[model samples]
Target: MSQTTIALTYDNLVNRIVPGPQSLSYFVPLVVLPIAFSIPPWIASKQTLCAVALPIISASLVHAWTVMGGIDVISFDMLLHSYHLLLFNDPRRHFRRILAKTATAEKTRTPKVGSRDGKDESTTPQYIEQPYPAKWSGRLPWIGTLLISMRFVDWKIGSPSHDSKQPDRNPTAPSHLRFILTAILRTLSGYVVLDLTSAWTQQDPYFKTFGVSVDSPLPQYALSGLLPPRLIRCTIMALQVWASVGQQFQLPCTLPVALHWMGYLPDAWSPHLWPTFFGSFRATFTTPNLGAVRNFWGRYWHQTLRYYCSGSGVWLANLMRLPRRSQSRYLLISATTFFFSGIVHIGLVPPEPIFALKSANQIRWLILVFFWLQPVGFAFETAVSVVLHHIGTPRLIYTILNILWFTAWCCFVLPFLGEAGRNLGYWRVWPVPVSLWQGITLGKWLAWV
Candidate 1:
C-alpha cells in the first residue's frame, strides 16, 4: 500500500487563526437568510420559517465535516458513502476468466440465458446472484411505493388481488380521513413526550408533573447545595428510554398519511393489506433478551443503508481472502459493524463547535466508547452461551440468564451517550405541528412542564 502525507497550514484554517482575527470568528459562525415563501408576511412572519434554518445549516456543515473530508476535514475510516454501498451490489467476481466472460456477455446483443460452446451460460454468472427482491412479485410493490412516497401519493393505481405475507395495521383505519386524523394525534403525543424530555434534560423545576424529579435527588440540582450529578445523569438515561418509545411509536412512522391529506401523496411503502409510508415498530424494540442482541440489531433494526454495514463484510472478506467458515473472521466482521455504529452515532452527538476543545471533547469520546465497545460485551455474552450449552445447562436457566445479561449490558452502556451531548443548554426546535401542539391538551401539558 502507498502512503501519502500533507502539511497543515493556517491559511486553510482561516489563516491568522494563530492570533485569531476577531471579526472573522463572528462572520464565519453566523448565517443570515431572507425569504418570501409566496405567503404574506403580515399573515405569517418570515422569522417563523427561518427559525429552523440556522441550526439546520450549522448541523449539516458540522455533520458533513465528520462524514466527508474536504479542506482540512477528516471523516472516519468506517464511513461508507451512499453510492459506495452500491459497489457491493454491482457484483463480485474473483476469477479473471469469469469476469471477462461476464463483461463480454454484457457488451454484446445477447440473451441473459444462452449457450456458449455447448456449455450452459448465463449473464447472471457463477459467483453472484441477481437481487431477489426486485424480481419477487410479492415484494415488487415496495419499489413502486418508494417512488410514490417522494410525491406523497397513495399507491392506489395498481391493486393487487392478494396481499403478500404482511400484518394488518392495528387500530385499523378504514378511511383516509381517519388515518390522517390518527397520525395528527400521534404526532402531537410524540411532541409532548419530546417536550417533557427536553425540560427534564434542562432540569427545569416545571418538570415536576412527570414525577421524575419528585422521587429522585433531582430537586437538589437547581437548589442551593452542591447538586448530586447522578440524579440528573440517571434522569437523562430514563429520558432517552422514554424518548425512544415516543420516537418509535410516534407519528413519524405514520405522518405520510397526513402529508397525503395535505396535498402530497402517500407512497405505498407498506404492503397492500397494511399499507403505510413507514411500517410498525412493534418488532423493532420488543421484549429484550440476551440472544436477542443478535436479533435486535440484525432483524429488528431498520436499515438506513440497506444492511450495508453487516453485508458489506461478506464482500470485504472475499476481497481480503478471509476464510468464510472461521469463527475469528465472523467476530472481526461483527466488531467492524460496531465500528460503523460508532461512526453513525458519533455524527449524532453535538459537535460543540463553539467549545473547540484543544484535546477534543471528552463527552463525545466517552459516548463513542459505549458504541465501539458494545460488540465486545456482546462477544462476551456469546462465549457465555457456548459454555452453558456445552455444559448442557437447562434451557429454562439459559433463557432467564440471557434476559438478565441483556438488561444489565444495555443499562451499563445506555447512560454514557444519553447524558453527554444533549445535557448542554442549547435549545432545539423539534419537528412537530405547532398548531396542534399549541392547542388544548398541549397547552395544559406545556404549562405543567
Candidate 2:
C-alpha cells in the first residue's frame, strides 16, 4: 500500500524470526537504558521533565529494537521459502535447480584447469564490486549524516523545557522564529487530538472479548448488525487519523523546534524534518485527500516505513518476471509488500512486557492481519483508478469517487484495526500536553475576539 522505505545499512542475521527462549531479554534494554540515562538537562523542571525524558527513551528503544531484532534485514525469498516449507512442506525445489545452473555458468566463465588466462585470473583475485561503505567516495554521505545526527543529539539534550522562558514574539526574535513557533503549537495540537482518540476506545470491550484471535475465521464487524458498528468504526478511524498527525508531529517535531530556538538543533535538520514528519498528518487529515487511499498512504501515512517494505516487493517482482505497469505486477507488489509489513508490524511489538502494544503471540498475529489485509484493498483501488483514468473521466469526479471508495474501505477495515490497536493499549497511551493546548487555544480565541 505505502511504498515508502527507510534506508537501513545492515543485513538480516537469520533466516527467520521467532520468539526465542530468551526473547524476553529484548525487553530488558528498553527499560534499563531509559532509566539508566534518565538525567534531563538543567532546563527541565518537574512539569517538563517527562516530555524531554520520554522521547529519549522512545527513540532509544525503537533504535535498539531495530538493531537487536534484525528488524533491518528481511530476505523475502528466504522468508517466503521458510513459510512454504513450514506450512505446506514445500521447499521450492525449483530455486535449487536455478541456483545450480547459476553456479555452473559462473564456474564455466571463470578460469579453468586448461584455460589461457586461468593461471593469471586465479592468481589475481580481483574485487569486482565492493558493497556499501567500503570505498573512499562512499563514506562522504555517511559522514554528513553522522555530523547531522550529532548535532541533533546535542540539541535534544539541551532543548528548552515546557517551564522555560518563551522566545521573543516579533519584537524579540528573527522573522523565521514565527514559523518554528507555529509548527510547535500545531504539532502539540496533534498530540492533543491523539489523546482524545485514545480516550474514546481505551477499554474496547469487543476487542477484549475477541481476546487472542478472531471469533470466527471472518471478523464479526457488524456488532449491532451493520449500521452501529460501521458508524463507530468511522468515528474511531477519523480520530485515529487525527491523533496520528499529532503523535508523529507533536513530539518528534516540536522538541526540535524548542531546541532550535534555544540554540540547540541546527538549521540543517529543522526545516526538512518538520514538513516530512509533521505535515504528513495534514495530507491525511485535509479535504480531497483524506479518503483517497493511494495518495493518503503513498504521500501521508508512509513517511517512516517505506524504504524497507518496498525493496522486498521490487526484488520479488523481479524474480516473478512481472513487467512494470501491468495490473499483475501492481497486485503482486502490493501483496508482497503488505505481507512483509505484517511481519514487520509483528516485529514492532517490542519483545518486552505487554504495556502499550499487544505483544502476545496470538494477539500479534491478529495485529498482523490488520497489515496483511491491506493489499487486497489497495489492489482493488488500483484497478478502479486505472479503469476510470482510461475512460477519461474528469479529475474532480475521479477524486470524489476515490474519496467515497476510501471512506467505505475505512468503514470496513477500521473496526478490525481499531479493536486490534485499542487492545494493544493504544488508548490513552501518551501523556496529554494540557498547557500546550490551553495556551494555543487561548491565543486563538483572543486573536478572534
Who wins the lDDT comparison?
A: 2
Best by TM-score: 2
* Alpha-carbon lDDT of model 2: 0.44
Write down the lDDT of every candidate, Cα atoms only. Answer: 0.41, 0.44
After superposition, which runs of candidate 1 have C-alpha atoms over 4 Å from their true positions? Answer: 1-79, 91-189, 204-289, 320-329, 349-361, 392-396, 422-449
Q: How do the residues 225-267 of candidate 1 rate in per-residue lDDT, one tens digit apiece?
A: 4544444444555555544543454345445555654547522
Provide the RMSD of all predictions against the true structure, rounded to 1 decimal: 17.6, 20.8
For candidate 1, the C-alpha RMSD (Å) to the true structure equals 17.6
Error of 2 at 444 (Å): 25
**Candidate 2 wrongly placed segments (more than 4 Å):** 1-179, 202-227, 244-247, 254-268, 273-275, 278-291, 319-322, 348-359, 390-392, 428-449
